[model samples]
Target: MDRHDELAARFEARRGRLRAIAHRMLGSARDADDAVQEAWLRLSRAGGAGIGNLTAWLTTVVSRVCLDMLRARTAHPEEPYGDDLPERAAGAGPEEEAVLADSVGLALLVVLETPSPAERVAVVLHDLFGVPFDRVAAITDRSLPAAKKLASRARHKVRGTPAVPAAEQDRHREVVEAFLAAARGGDLDALLGLLAEDVVRRADPATLPPGVAAELRGARAVAEGTVLLRERARFAAPALVDGRVGLVVAPRGQLRYVLRVTVEGDRVTAYEVVAGPARLRGLKLAVLDVPAADWAPDAPEGSPSSW
Candidate 1:
């Protein structure tokens, strides 16, 4: 095969890994696809010229493309989040399923989004992909030490808000399930019992189109806020968010809320309800029916899950 054909084959071999990296960096499958396409274009134009590691070179190209896109996106924000998982047959291979599961996990992606582009690139390279700091620095266009520092900072930020113990996370799910049941049943007392005194709930202000209440604070305020959605909002499914139990609620088919229940000891300390399609889109959740069986809590930890 010609050098160009050889290069194309090499690029194809790394497609799955490249897509995963880009998806984690860009937080959108569509954007990741675009970035990868752009990377391929760059590679094709370069021909057989001077690239040492094809995978590393392609990764850098995709990273740069994604960074530019992210910067532009900040100037013109789009819908915040949505499902980006590619549909697959039920008989897909275990490796494909694992990749799909990790790629679409809302909590990990959300945490990655908190960092700057450089920090994200550094962390994903060094931590996730096992790239050394010197290599990461070259890819991210930073000095070796600077790249290490960026990765360190990203690690600190993420580890500081580590996922709650699996057991606590499971208990949180139970609390949320109970609350949802009570809400659907219109049992105000049971619903209130599940909430903390200083609970805070916020809807995506962008969705309201001006002059609408965006934030609701305090237990009483939060309880009253639910009243507005009493008949409209419906719970579709539940997931373990950042090692915490959480539920997805849709109002009028727009995916209005992601309710993350916070627990401290035996009592619920906070119920953070993130609503509105704009914000809910950040969580790429698979819409599934919530099972009735009680999911056993994973092992307990001292800290709660970061919502």
Candidate 2:
């Protein structure tokens, strides 16, 4: 094969890993897909010559693209989930480490969303990918110590007790499953039993329309919101959200409304529901149809099982 063909082969091999990283970093699968495509375009033009680490190079490219997108995203606003909103992956194969670093769970991704572009690059590279400060410095165009500090700051902001243990996560899963069953069956009390006394359900402010930014607090409000959603929106399959049980809701005749549920102890404590055409693109979900059974609690990890 010619050098171009050879280079194309190499780039294709790394697409999955690169896309996974971009998805984690961008928080939108569609954006990640775009970033990966852009990275390949760059690689094709440059040719695959004299590259010390092809994986790292592609990761850097993808990160840069995502960073640019994030910069532009700041200008536009998002929407809130409908009043009827439901409360709702790993490994790079070698050369895959750079992209696989921090792309694990929803909690980590949400935490990552709070940092500036530079801080995200720093923390994700050093803390998650094990990349040295010097290399992170290069990628972020900052001094080594400055890069270290940025990562430190980001880490501090997101620091918390260790995540709920895996076994505990399983238990949470059971509770969430029961809650879903009850909600789908229109059992109000059964659904409320799965929520904490102080449960809070807030729509994604970025996606909600004006005059629709609503926050449902307390178990009663949450339970009420659940009923509203069940009566209105349809759901795609259930996907494991942040390593816990969760599902995605796509409203009838609407292209958005992705809900992710966070279960604490035996009750639901947090609900993150996002709605917007752009954000929904990355979710790879149907426009108005409820997701398939594949999105249920037992679906494979990282599947578009839930929002």
Predicted candidate 2 versus true structure: per-residue lDDT over 1-307, tens digit per residue: 9899888887887787677566655655556788999999999888877787777787778877876876665555343344544232133132232122212322344444456867766665555445567767877788988988988887765553324675785676577657766666567898778888888888767544465446878988778777765533223324444434555543211224556678777888877676655565444221111224311222112222211
- How many backbone clashes are present in model 1? 7
Winning model by lDDT: 2
Relative to the true structure, candidate 1 reaches a TM of: 0.56
The RMSD (Cα, Å) of candidate 1 is 11.0
Model 1, 1-307: lDDT tens digits are 9888998997887787677667666655567788899888988999848987666677678877877876675566544332221334456553443333323222334444456767877776556555667777877788988999999987665542326665665566577667666555556677678778877666555433355466767766677666555432332345544445566543211234566667665445565556555445455343222232211112221011210
Model 2, position 65: C-alpha lDDT score: 83
Q: Against the hidden reference, what TM-scores do the models get?
A: 0.56, 0.55
Best by TM-score: 1
CA shift of 152, model 2, Å: 1.0
